[model samples]
Target: MNSKLVILGGGAAGVLIAMKLASQNIDVTLIDSKTFYEYTPALCSVLYEETDAKFHQHFSEISFELEPFLRKINVEFILGNAKLIKDDKVFIHQREEGIEYDYLVICTGSSYADPWKTQNGTECIDLNRRINFLNEQREKYKQAQHILCIGGGPVGVEVATEISYRAPGKKITLVDMNKTVLANAPDGIGNNAQRILNARDSITSIMEQSASQKGQEGNTYIYETDKSHTEIKADLVYNCIGVTPNSEFLQANHADWLNEKKQIIVDPGLRVTSNVFAVGDVNSVNEPKMFYTAHMQAIHFVRNMSRIIKNNTNVENLIPYHPSRPNMIVSMGPQYAIGYVSGIKLTGWPLGLNKGSHLASWGKYTIERITMNSCHLKIPVNEVLYLTSRP
Candidate 1:
């Protein structure tokens, strides 16, 4: 009989693992709350202008139907939540018998503060709803003259830049509690991002300030800054503040398996228990929480799983995973970007070009294409120039 392997969360790590294990003798089953896999790295670009040379695309364009994609690779896809994990049996919503697995992998990723990351409490049921919701947000943003973005991380900075590029007249206020944007990153990256944001006419960088929403009065929402005690009013607001792990299902029964941040505690081999494993952002791994890092973890997990299966469920021979510092790139807009690679700081444009002519988008797009292609999906380069375009 084939070894039964069940994976939770159809994000980057889980999907890649299923794809790799499909060709093996293991009977792989992937369970996710959502029906599709979203390329979340490009999600902020959905606010970009609708032009021939645009960075943003419709949600359906970036997302792939998880059920069909997994089916094509001989992996069974289940659309439900993993409600409980007891012994060797995993119980899900609406499924009574539960699934018995020789091995279980938890790759449930993090949830963002924005609705685009999750709608209502879970993912949107299908693609049309996601598209409609994104369209509504775009229309609301277009109508608003003033917008407030709370956070200085990659998502916040990227959203601000996209709005500035799409509509230069809109007043965009970026507030961060830190002294500089990208504070967790290297000093050079933070300084570069600060300079880029400062150069934009429509963007106002308000550092070392925390804003709390007081209330909304008609079209304008009111906020109070913690440091200055000054009032900030905006027509639209994005709470790009925190990332919460989607590991609530583990809380009831397996509380000891999670850390204080609710991330699953894994061993050197990425195992939560003898028969269970966790990877990606959901695990308490000491690595940068980037999409590519999650991919690396997934690949490592595959190798260990292969060993465990070959040794007749013996994990003693499993290889340990060691994480290295990952390279990161952040785009200020379509024209500019900054990156950190191999302990070297990089400008968006390689040849010491002006700040506004950064080709960081080129690298970002290339990474996006590579990620999509790994899952057997190729982005068509018909109207959108994949290589030469700045975005």
Candidate 2:
């Protein structure tokens, strides 16, 4: 009998793993909730007009590109959300049909948490929504004199900087409870960002106890913090706190596999309990949550799976997962960016242009080309069963 391999979540990790395994003729099947794969890293860039939104395309096109290659390797694609896993089989639910898999890989990407009080409140997950929200705030603040941005992380700083660039007439105040912005980044990064934002005529950075309202009549957002309360008259407020893992399904099902943060705990080889593997932001790793790191983890896991399927004695000696070298391409606006690459810190136009073009070109060419070449090999099942089965 042919050994079956199923992958859940068609995000970067899921798709990459499936493509790798299918190339080795592992009878691979991929599943996802959405038909389109959004390039999340570019979403902010798209909003800032550094890249075109049309760059985000349907996954079907990607699937089509892989069809011939995958068929040659005996791999199949399924569109559905996996609901549960029992023993060696996975249960999937789409419209009204049910399906199962022999070996499963979970890669369901994350979703933003709802910000409202209600359980079914609106949650912003995509680039368009974030852009629309920012645009709406821009319009709303056009008549006012001040704007307040909450949170001081990378997202918060980027949004504030962009708004400052777009609306020179309005006063932009960035508020954070921490001592400085970009707290998790290297020492100079946050200070440099602060300097850059401070240089702008319309931007101001405030480190204090949150703001409080003395009176609720005027159009202002008040935040209450620990030390003292400060009030600023503002027409709009943008909140860019942080991200949480997308693990609701796992929590509801195999909670035992998860750690305290709700991230799936994988062994050194990236395999979970049984013949399962987890990757992407959904899995706990020492590295920051970013696209490149997730892709690397997926690639590593795929190689291990290939070894198992090849009856290779060195499967346990597969390459270990490592965090990518510290590199960040943060664009301040259309013309300005800051980051470090290959241990060199960069700022201004060179940073902006290189990052912008790199992002755009990567999306347009590199990913697709890599996917094409990596998804076209075939391997036998007996090798996997022989190598992986418990002695």
Task: List TM-scores for all candidates, in order.
Answer: 0.90, 0.72
Tens-place lDDT digits, model 2, residues 1-391: 5567888776667766765676564678776654434455534333433222332332222333333434565667665566666667666554444455656778876554222111111221333443344455334645666767777876667767766665577788888876777766653666566667767778777874454444444666555444655556666666656466666666556899888888888877677765777888888776767655667677667767777777743544655565555545565654566665445555543444322323423332333444333343112221232233212
Residues 19-137, model 1: lDDT tens digits: 77898889999988788888888777755656523423445456889988898889999887878799798888757888889899999888887554753243336666666666677
By lDDT, who's the top model here?
1
State residue 22's C-alpha deviation in candidate 1, in Å. Answer: 1.0
Can you tell me which runs of candidate 2 are displaced by over 4 Å? Answer: 48-75, 93-98, 113-147, 208-221, 233-235, 312-319, 348-391
Overall lDDT per candidate, in order of appearance: 0.78, 0.58
Give the range of the ten consecutive residues with the poorest summed lDDT in model 1.
382-391
